[model samples]
Target chain A: TQLLEQSPQFLSIQEGENLTVYCNSSSVFSSLQWYRQEPGEGPVLLVTVVTGGEVKKLKRLTFQFGDARKDSSLHITAAQTGDTGLYLCAVPASGGSYIPTFGRGTSLIVHP
Target chain B: DAGITQSPRHKVTETGTPVTLRCHQTENHRYMYWYRQDPGHGLRLIHYSYGVKDTDKGEVSDGYSVSRSKTEDFLLTLESATSSQTSVYFCAISARDRVRNEQFFGPGTRLTVL
Candidate 1:
Protein backbone atom coordinates (compact mmCIF):
# COMPACT_ATOMS: atom_id res chain seq x y z
CA THR A 1 0.00 0.00 0.00
CA GLN A 2 1.21 3.52 -0.80
CA LEU A 3 1.53 5.82 2.17
CA LEU A 4 1.31 9.61 2.16
CA GLU A 5 2.38 11.50 5.26
CA GLN A 6 1.38 15.06 6.08
CA SER A 7 3.41 17.24 8.38
CA PRO A 8 2.31 19.68 11.12
CA GLN A 9 -0.90 17.76 11.75
CA PHE A 10 -2.35 20.92 13.28
CA LEU A 11 -1.81 24.62 12.74
CA SER A 12 -3.29 27.82 14.09
CA ILE A 13 -2.55 31.24 12.73
CA GLN A 14 -3.91 34.77 12.80
CA GLU A 15 -5.68 36.13 9.80
CA GLY A 16 -3.33 37.55 7.17
CA GLU A 17 -0.60 35.11 8.17
CA ASN A 18 0.82 32.63 5.70
CA LEU A 19 1.00 28.86 6.10
CA THR A 20 2.25 25.88 4.21
CA VAL A 21 1.30 22.20 4.47
CA TYR A 22 3.40 19.40 3.10
CA CYS A 23 2.52 15.95 1.76
CA ASN A 24 5.26 13.44 1.10
CA SER A 25 5.27 9.91 -0.27
CA SER A 26 7.89 7.32 -1.18
CA SER A 27 6.00 5.91 -4.12
CA VAL A 28 5.48 7.76 -7.37
CA PHE A 29 2.01 8.85 -8.40
CA SER A 30 0.44 9.53 -11.77
CA SER A 31 -1.68 12.34 -10.38
CA LEU A 32 -2.01 14.14 -7.07
CA GLN A 33 -4.97 16.06 -5.69
CA TRP A 34 -5.57 18.43 -2.79
CA TYR A 35 -8.87 18.77 -0.95
CA ARG A 36 -10.31 21.01 1.70
CA GLN A 37 -12.95 19.74 4.14
CA GLU A 38 -14.98 21.87 6.44
CA PRO A 39 -16.35 20.58 9.71
CA GLY A 40 -19.26 18.13 9.29
CA GLU A 41 -18.73 17.80 5.56
CA GLY A 42 -16.83 15.62 3.14
CA PRO A 43 -13.70 16.96 1.50
CA VAL A 44 -13.97 19.14 -1.59
CA LEU A 45 -11.34 19.07 -4.29
CA LEU A 46 -9.07 22.11 -4.38
CA VAL A 47 -6.63 21.20 -7.11
CA THR A 48 -5.15 18.31 -9.05
CA VAL A 49 -1.54 18.33 -10.26
CA VAL A 50 -0.72 15.83 -12.99
CA THR A 51 2.80 16.78 -13.91
CA GLY A 52 6.01 16.98 -11.99
CA GLY A 53 6.99 20.47 -10.88
CA GLU A 54 3.54 21.71 -11.67
CA VAL A 55 2.09 24.69 -9.86
CA LYS A 56 -1.48 25.87 -9.83
CA LYS A 57 -2.98 28.90 -8.18
CA LEU A 58 -6.53 29.58 -7.11
CA LYS A 59 -7.02 32.97 -5.57
CA ARG A 60 -4.85 32.96 -2.46
CA LEU A 61 -4.15 29.22 -2.47
CA THR A 62 -1.12 27.82 -4.25
CA PHE A 63 -0.50 24.12 -4.90
CA GLN A 64 2.77 22.62 -6.03
CA PHE A 65 3.70 19.09 -7.12
CA GLY A 66 7.22 17.79 -6.56
CA ASP A 67 9.69 17.37 -9.34
CA ALA A 68 9.77 13.65 -8.61
CA ARG A 69 6.00 13.25 -8.35
CA LYS A 70 6.50 11.91 -4.84
CA ASP A 71 5.51 14.98 -2.89
CA SER A 72 3.30 18.05 -2.95
CA SER A 73 2.71 21.23 -1.00
CA LEU A 74 -0.08 23.75 -0.41
CA HIS A 75 0.51 27.37 0.56
CA ILE A 76 -2.06 29.89 1.65
CA THR A 77 -1.26 33.58 1.57
CA ALA A 78 -3.05 36.25 3.60
CA ALA A 79 -5.14 33.60 5.28
CA GLN A 80 -8.60 34.46 6.46
CA THR A 81 -11.02 32.99 8.96
CA GLY A 82 -12.80 31.28 6.09
CA ASP A 83 -9.57 29.46 5.23
CA THR A 84 -9.82 27.28 8.31
CA GLY A 85 -10.42 23.62 7.46
CA LEU A 86 -8.80 20.23 7.03
CA TYR A 87 -6.59 19.86 4.02
CA LEU A 88 -5.86 16.45 2.53
CA CYS A 89 -3.65 15.13 -0.23
CA ALA A 90 -4.50 12.07 -2.29
CA VAL A 91 -2.82 10.05 -5.00
CA PRO A 92 -4.09 7.30 -7.27
CA ALA A 93 -2.29 4.02 -6.89
CA SER A 94 0.14 3.16 -9.64
CA GLY A 95 0.06 0.03 -11.87
CA GLY A 96 -3.42 0.52 -13.33
CA SER A 97 -5.38 0.74 -10.10
CA TYR A 98 -7.10 4.07 -9.72
CA ILE A 99 -7.82 3.55 -6.05
CA PRO A 100 -6.68 6.58 -4.08
CA THR A 101 -4.44 6.65 -1.04
CA PHE A 102 -4.94 9.64 1.24
CA GLY A 103 -2.71 11.54 3.61
CA ARG A 104 -3.76 11.89 7.23
CA GLY A 105 -4.51 15.59 6.60
CA THR A 106 -3.46 18.95 8.00
CA SER A 107 -5.99 20.81 10.09
CA LEU A 108 -5.56 24.55 9.81
CA ILE A 109 -7.29 27.24 11.80
CA VAL A 110 -7.00 30.83 10.72
CA HIS A 111 -8.07 33.11 13.51
CA PRO A 112 -9.18 36.68 12.98
CA ASP B 1 -20.57 18.40 -6.47
CA ALA B 2 -20.63 14.71 -7.54
CA GLY B 3 -24.33 14.38 -6.66
CA ILE B 4 -23.85 11.79 -3.90
CA THR B 5 -26.00 11.16 -0.84
CA GLN B 6 -25.57 8.90 2.19
CA SER B 7 -28.47 7.90 4.41
CA PRO B 8 -28.70 7.48 8.18
CA ARG B 9 -26.66 10.60 8.74
CA HIS B 10 -26.15 9.50 12.32
CA LYS B 11 -26.59 6.04 13.88
CA VAL B 12 -26.11 4.55 17.32
CA THR B 13 -26.01 0.77 17.51
CA GLU B 14 -25.10 -2.03 19.87
CA THR B 15 -22.36 -4.51 19.32
CA GLY B 16 -23.17 -7.61 17.27
CA THR B 17 -26.03 -5.87 15.51
CA PRO B 18 -26.23 -5.59 11.79
CA VAL B 19 -25.86 -2.11 10.28
CA THR B 20 -26.10 -0.90 6.74
CA LEU B 21 -25.29 2.54 5.32
CA ARG B 22 -26.72 3.57 2.01
CA CYS B 23 -25.04 5.76 -0.61
CA HIS B 24 -27.13 7.03 -3.45
CA GLN B 25 -25.93 8.95 -6.49
CA THR B 26 -27.75 10.82 -9.23
CA GLU B 27 -24.85 11.27 -11.65
CA ASN B 28 -24.83 7.62 -12.80
CA HIS B 29 -21.10 7.40 -12.24
CA ARG B 30 -19.35 4.14 -13.02
CA TYR B 31 -17.11 3.90 -9.98
CA MET B 32 -18.17 3.84 -6.34
CA TYR B 33 -16.20 3.48 -3.11
CA TRP B 34 -16.70 3.10 0.68
CA TYR B 35 -14.29 4.54 3.21
CA ARG B 36 -14.04 5.00 6.96
CA GLN B 37 -12.38 8.00 8.59
CA ASP B 38 -10.72 7.73 11.99
CA PRO B 39 -8.85 10.28 14.08
CA GLY B 40 -5.32 8.95 13.57
CA HIS B 41 -5.86 6.67 10.61
CA GLY B 42 -7.26 9.25 8.23
CA LEU B 43 -9.48 7.70 5.55
CA ARG B 44 -9.19 4.01 4.85
CA LEU B 45 -10.84 2.29 1.96
CA ILE B 46 -13.21 -0.53 2.88
CA HIS B 47 -14.42 -1.51 -0.57
CA TYR B 48 -14.98 -0.15 -4.05
CA SER B 49 -17.21 -1.06 -6.98
CA TYR B 50 -16.18 -0.55 -10.56
CA GLY B 51 -19.59 -1.40 -11.93
CA VAL B 52 -22.91 -2.83 -10.90
CA LYS B 53 -22.36 -6.08 -8.98
CA ASP B 54 -18.63 -5.76 -9.44
CA THR B 55 -16.95 -4.96 -6.17
CA ASP B 56 -13.55 -5.48 -4.58
CA LYS B 57 -12.21 -5.37 -1.08
CA GLY B 58 -10.00 -2.49 0.04
CA GLU B 59 -7.33 -2.28 2.73
CA VAL B 60 -9.68 -2.59 5.67
CA SER B 61 -12.47 -4.89 4.56
CA ASP B 62 -12.43 -7.52 7.27
CA GLY B 63 -15.98 -7.31 8.68
CA TYR B 64 -17.51 -5.05 6.06
CA SER B 65 -19.39 -5.93 2.89
CA VAL B 66 -20.73 -3.88 0.01
CA SER B 67 -23.34 -4.29 -2.71
CA ARG B 68 -24.07 -2.25 -5.81
CA SER B 69 -27.24 -3.50 -7.37
CA LYS B 70 -27.88 -0.36 -9.41
CA THR B 71 -25.74 2.36 -10.83
CA GLU B 72 -27.18 4.91 -8.45
CA ASP B 73 -26.94 3.09 -5.14
CA PHE B 74 -24.12 1.43 -3.18
CA LEU B 75 -24.71 -0.34 0.08
CA LEU B 76 -22.21 -1.02 2.85
CA THR B 77 -23.03 -3.58 5.51
CA LEU B 78 -21.38 -4.40 8.78
CA GLU B 79 -22.21 -8.00 9.60
CA SER B 80 -21.51 -7.63 13.32
CA ALA B 81 -20.82 -4.22 14.69
CA THR B 82 -18.04 -3.67 17.16
CA SER B 83 -16.88 -0.74 19.22
CA SER B 84 -13.79 -0.47 17.07
CA GLN B 85 -15.96 -0.11 13.98
CA THR B 86 -17.45 3.17 15.16
CA SER B 87 -16.38 6.06 12.98
CA VAL B 88 -17.42 8.44 10.24
CA TYR B 89 -18.03 6.72 6.92
CA PHE B 90 -17.88 8.37 3.51
CA CYS B 91 -18.99 7.24 0.07
CA ALA B 92 -17.51 8.56 -3.16
CA ILE B 93 -18.18 8.16 -6.88
CA SER B 94 -16.21 8.89 -10.02
CA ALA B 95 -17.66 9.51 -13.43
CA ARG B 96 -14.81 8.22 -15.58
CA ASP B 97 -12.84 5.06 -14.91
CA ARG B 98 -10.78 4.97 -11.72
CA VAL B 99 -7.62 5.62 -13.68
CA ARG B 100 -8.32 9.24 -14.52
CA ASN B 101 -11.40 10.63 -12.86
CA GLU B 102 -11.95 12.91 -9.91
CA GLN B 103 -14.08 11.46 -7.10
CA PHE B 104 -17.03 13.27 -5.54
CA PHE B 105 -17.82 12.36 -1.94
CA GLY B 106 -21.06 12.31 0.00
CA PRO B 107 -21.68 14.29 3.16
CA GLY B 108 -20.78 11.23 5.32
CA THR B 109 -22.42 9.19 8.06
CA ARG B 110 -21.43 9.13 11.70
CA LEU B 111 -21.87 5.78 13.45
CA THR B 112 -21.41 5.09 17.13
CA VAL B 113 -21.23 1.49 18.33
CA LEU B 114 -21.65 0.70 21.96
Candidate 2:
Protein backbone atom coordinates (compact mmCIF):
# COMPACT_ATOMS: atom_id res chain seq x y z
CA THR A 1 0.00 0.00 0.00
CA GLN A 2 1.37 3.40 -1.00
CA LEU A 3 0.44 5.60 1.93
CA LEU A 4 -0.15 9.27 1.18
CA GLU A 5 0.01 11.65 4.10
CA GLN A 6 -2.10 14.79 3.96
CA SER A 7 -1.24 17.68 6.23
CA PRO A 8 -3.48 20.01 8.26
CA GLN A 9 -6.15 17.55 9.28
CA PHE A 10 -8.52 20.47 9.79
CA LEU A 11 -8.69 24.07 8.64
CA SER A 12 -11.04 26.96 9.28
CA ILE A 13 -10.71 30.31 7.61
CA GLN A 14 -12.77 33.36 6.84
CA GLU A 15 -14.17 33.86 3.37
CA GLY A 16 -11.79 35.42 0.87
CA GLU A 17 -8.76 33.91 2.55
CA ASN A 18 -6.34 31.81 0.57
CA LEU A 19 -5.25 28.35 1.71
CA THR A 20 -3.12 25.47 0.60
CA VAL A 21 -3.31 21.78 1.54
CA TYR A 22 -0.44 19.39 1.06
CA CYS A 23 -0.19 15.66 0.36
CA ASN A 24 3.16 13.94 0.67
CA SER A 25 4.37 10.39 0.29
CA SER A 26 7.73 8.67 0.27
CA SER A 27 6.62 6.29 -2.45
CA VAL A 28 6.59 7.32 -6.07
CA PHE A 29 3.31 7.38 -7.91
CA SER A 30 2.57 7.17 -11.59
CA SER A 31 -0.42 9.47 -11.09
CA LEU A 32 -2.19 11.34 -8.35
CA GLN A 33 -5.79 12.44 -7.97
CA TRP A 34 -7.54 15.02 -5.82
CA TYR A 35 -11.12 14.86 -4.59
CA ARG A 36 -13.58 16.94 -2.58
CA GLN A 37 -16.33 15.37 -0.53
CA GLU A 38 -19.24 17.06 1.15
CA PRO A 39 -20.91 15.72 4.27
CA GLY A 40 -23.31 12.87 3.60
CA GLU A 41 -22.14 12.37 0.03
CA GLY A 42 -19.47 10.55 -1.92
CA PRO A 43 -16.29 12.25 -3.03
CA VAL A 44 -16.11 14.02 -6.38
CA LEU A 45 -12.95 13.97 -8.45
CA LEU A 46 -11.35 17.40 -8.72
CA VAL A 47 -8.32 16.72 -10.88
CA THR A 48 -5.70 14.19 -11.88
CA VAL A 49 -2.04 15.01 -12.37
CA VAL A 50 0.09 12.58 -14.33
CA THR A 51 3.28 14.47 -15.01
CA GLY A 52 5.98 15.72 -12.72
CA GLY A 53 5.96 19.46 -12.08
CA GLU A 54 2.50 19.62 -13.58
CA VAL A 55 -0.09 22.21 -12.66
CA LYS A 56 -3.80 22.16 -13.34
CA LYS A 57 -6.31 24.84 -12.49
CA LEU A 58 -10.03 24.61 -12.01
CA LYS A 59 -11.12 28.23 -11.85
CA ARG A 60 -10.32 29.22 -8.26
CA LEU A 61 -8.43 26.07 -7.42
CA THR A 62 -4.91 25.13 -8.47
CA PHE A 63 -3.32 21.68 -8.22
CA GLN A 64 0.38 21.01 -8.53
CA PHE A 65 2.37 17.81 -8.73
CA GLY A 66 5.86 17.62 -7.34
CA ASP A 67 8.74 17.31 -9.74
CA ALA A 68 9.62 14.04 -8.01
CA ARG A 69 6.03 12.85 -8.39
CA LYS A 70 5.91 12.00 -4.70
CA ASP A 71 3.96 15.01 -3.44
CA SER A 72 1.08 17.27 -4.44
CA SER A 73 -0.71 20.37 -3.25
CA LEU A 74 -4.00 22.14 -3.70
CA HIS A 75 -4.39 25.91 -3.45
CA ILE A 76 -7.74 27.59 -3.21
CA THR A 77 -7.97 31.27 -4.06
CA ALA A 78 -10.38 33.52 -2.17
CA ALA A 79 -12.13 30.72 -0.41
CA GLN A 80 -15.89 30.75 -0.09
CA THR A 81 -18.36 28.82 2.03
CA GLY A 82 -18.93 26.56 -0.93
CA ASP A 83 -15.24 25.67 -0.86
CA THR A 84 -15.66 24.00 2.52
CA GLY A 85 -15.37 20.25 2.45
CA LEU A 86 -12.96 17.36 2.94
CA TYR A 87 -10.08 17.18 0.50
CA LEU A 88 -8.32 13.90 -0.25
CA CYS A 89 -5.36 12.79 -2.34
CA ALA A 90 -5.10 9.28 -3.73
CA VAL A 91 -2.77 7.07 -5.71
CA PRO A 92 -3.30 3.66 -7.23
CA ALA A 93 -1.45 0.59 -6.07
CA SER A 94 1.60 -0.55 -7.97
CA GLY A 95 2.00 -3.64 -10.22
CA GLY A 96 -0.89 -2.70 -12.48
CA SER A 97 -3.56 -3.02 -9.79
CA TYR A 98 -5.21 0.35 -10.07
CA ILE A 99 -7.01 0.12 -6.74
CA PRO A 100 -6.69 3.51 -5.08
CA THR A 101 -5.30 4.17 -1.63
CA PHE A 102 -6.59 7.40 -0.07
CA GLY A 103 -5.17 9.69 2.52
CA ARG A 104 -6.97 10.46 5.76
CA GLY A 105 -7.99 13.83 4.24
CA THR A 106 -8.08 17.49 5.23
CA SER A 107 -11.34 18.99 6.36
CA LEU A 108 -11.67 22.63 5.36
CA ILE A 109 -14.27 24.95 6.74
CA VAL A 110 -14.73 28.33 5.12
CA HIS A 111 -16.70 30.79 7.21
CA PRO A 112 -18.87 33.34 5.54
CA ASP B 1 -24.28 11.83 -10.31
CA ALA B 2 -22.75 8.63 -11.70
CA GLY B 3 -26.09 7.01 -12.42
CA ILE B 4 -25.32 4.88 -9.36
CA THR B 5 -27.59 4.13 -6.42
CA GLN B 6 -27.07 2.35 -3.11
CA SER B 7 -30.06 0.86 -1.40
CA PRO B 8 -31.08 1.45 2.21
CA ARG B 9 -29.18 4.74 2.35
CA HIS B 10 -29.46 4.33 6.11
CA LYS B 11 -29.68 1.03 7.96
CA VAL B 12 -29.66 -0.05 11.60
CA THR B 13 -28.97 -3.64 12.53
CA GLU B 14 -27.80 -5.65 15.51
CA THR B 15 -24.59 -7.54 16.03
CA GLY B 16 -24.43 -11.24 15.21
CA THR B 17 -26.96 -10.73 12.42
CA PRO B 18 -26.52 -10.74 8.70
CA VAL B 19 -26.74 -7.52 6.71
CA THR B 20 -26.39 -6.87 3.03
CA LEU B 21 -25.91 -3.62 1.13
CA ARG B 22 -26.71 -3.27 -2.52
CA CYS B 23 -25.13 -1.14 -5.20
CA HIS B 24 -26.81 -0.59 -8.58
CA GLN B 25 -25.47 1.28 -11.58
CA THR B 26 -26.98 2.28 -14.91
CA GLU B 27 -23.80 3.03 -16.82
CA ASN B 28 -22.94 -0.59 -17.56
CA HIS B 29 -19.41 -0.07 -16.30
CA ARG B 30 -17.07 -3.06 -16.17
CA TYR B 31 -15.54 -2.54 -12.76
CA MET B 32 -17.28 -2.20 -9.38
CA TYR B 33 -15.86 -1.70 -5.90
CA TRP B 34 -17.07 -1.50 -2.31
CA TYR B 35 -15.39 0.66 0.30
CA ARG B 36 -15.93 1.84 3.85
CA GLN B 37 -15.42 5.37 5.14
CA ASP B 38 -14.30 6.01 8.67
CA PRO B 39 -12.85 8.90 10.61
CA GLY B 40 -9.07 9.12 10.15
CA HIS B 41 -9.25 6.19 7.76
CA GLY B 42 -10.28 7.91 4.54
CA LEU B 43 -11.91 5.28 2.35
CA ARG B 44 -10.78 1.67 2.66
CA LEU B 45 -11.47 -0.86 -0.05
CA ILE B 46 -13.50 -3.87 0.99
CA HIS B 47 -13.84 -5.68 -2.31
CA TYR B 48 -13.99 -5.18 -6.08
CA SER B 49 -15.20 -6.95 -9.19
CA TYR B 50 -13.91 -6.93 -12.73
CA GLY B 51 -16.90 -8.63 -14.30
CA VAL B 52 -20.02 -10.60 -13.56
CA LYS B 53 -19.36 -13.23 -10.87
CA ASP B 54 -15.72 -12.22 -10.64
CA THR B 55 -14.66 -10.62 -7.36
CA ASP B 56 -11.61 -10.07 -5.20
CA LYS B 57 -10.82 -8.96 -1.68
CA GLY B 58 -9.46 -5.57 -0.76
CA GLU B 59 -7.38 -4.13 2.06
CA VAL B 60 -10.17 -4.33 4.62
CA SER B 61 -12.01 -7.44 3.57
CA ASP B 62 -12.26 -9.26 6.87
CA GLY B 63 -15.80 -9.98 8.04
CA TYR B 64 -17.15 -8.81 4.70
CA SER B 65 -18.07 -10.63 1.51
CA VAL B 66 -19.28 -9.36 -1.83
CA SER B 67 -21.15 -10.84 -4.81
CA ARG B 68 -21.82 -9.55 -8.29
CA SER B 69 -24.15 -11.84 -10.12
CA LYS B 70 -24.89 -9.21 -12.74
CA THR B 71 -22.85 -6.53 -14.39
CA GLU B 72 -24.78 -3.63 -12.91
CA ASP B 73 -25.42 -4.89 -9.40
CA PHE B 74 -22.87 -5.58 -6.67
CA LEU B 75 -23.85 -6.83 -3.26
CA LEU B 76 -21.83 -6.71 -0.04
CA THR B 77 -22.70 -8.96 2.85
CA LEU B 78 -21.62 -9.07 6.45
CA GLU B 79 -21.88 -12.54 7.89
CA SER B 80 -22.04 -11.21 11.40
CA ALA B 81 -22.50 -7.52 11.86
CA THR B 82 -20.57 -5.95 14.67
CA SER B 83 -20.42 -2.54 16.29
CA SER B 84 -16.93 -2.17 14.86
CA GLN B 85 -18.41 -2.63 11.40
CA THR B 86 -20.64 0.42 11.64
CA SER B 87 -19.61 3.00 9.08
CA VAL B 88 -20.52 4.64 5.79
CA TYR B 89 -20.12 2.33 2.78
CA PHE B 90 -19.60 3.57 -0.75
CA CYS B 91 -19.81 1.86 -4.14
CA ALA B 92 -17.68 2.95 -7.09
CA ILE B 93 -17.33 1.94 -10.72
CA SER B 94 -14.84 2.52 -13.51
CA ALA B 95 -15.97 2.44 -17.10
CA ARG B 96 -12.69 0.88 -18.22
CA ASP B 97 -9.86 -0.94 -16.52
CA ARG B 98 -9.24 0.91 -13.27
CA VAL B 99 -5.58 1.44 -14.13
CA ARG B 100 -6.55 3.85 -16.90
CA ASN B 101 -9.90 5.21 -15.75
CA GLU B 102 -11.51 7.36 -13.11
CA GLN B 103 -14.00 5.89 -10.69
CA PHE B 104 -17.51 7.18 -10.15
CA PHE B 105 -18.93 6.71 -6.66
CA GLY B 106 -22.44 6.26 -5.37
CA PRO B 107 -23.99 8.49 -2.71
CA GLY B 108 -23.12 5.99 0.09
CA THR B 109 -24.97 4.07 2.77
CA ARG B 110 -24.71 4.71 6.50
CA LEU B 111 -25.00 1.61 8.63
CA THR B 112 -25.25 1.38 12.41
CA VAL B 113 -24.78 -1.81 14.38
CA LEU B 114 -26.12 -1.99 17.88
Candidate 2, residue A12: lDDT: 98
- Write model 1 residue lDDT over A1-112, tens digit each, in one string: 8889998899999999999999998988788889998999998988889889999999999999999999999999999999999999988756667577889999999988
Residue-level lDDT tens digits of model 2 in A2-105: 88999899999999999999999999888888989998999898988889999999999999999999999999999999999999998865786747778999
Q: For every model shown, what is its TM-score relative to the native structure?
A: 0.95, 0.95
Please identify model 1 stretches exceeding 4 Å from their true place. Answer: B96-99
Tens digits of per-residue lDDT, candidate 1, B41-65, equal 8889999998999999999999999
What CA root-mean-square deviation does each model show from the true structure? 1.4, 1.5
lDDT of 1 at B53: 98
Deviation (Å) of A69 in candidate 2: 1.4
For model 2, the superposed segments whose C-alpha errors exceed 4 Å read B96-100
Q: Considering summed lDDT, which 10 consecutive residues are worst modelled in model 1 chain A?
A: A92-101
- i-RMSD of all predictions: 1.8, 2.1
- Which DockQ-derived CAPRI band holds candidate 2? medium
- The lDDT per prediction is 0.91, 0.91
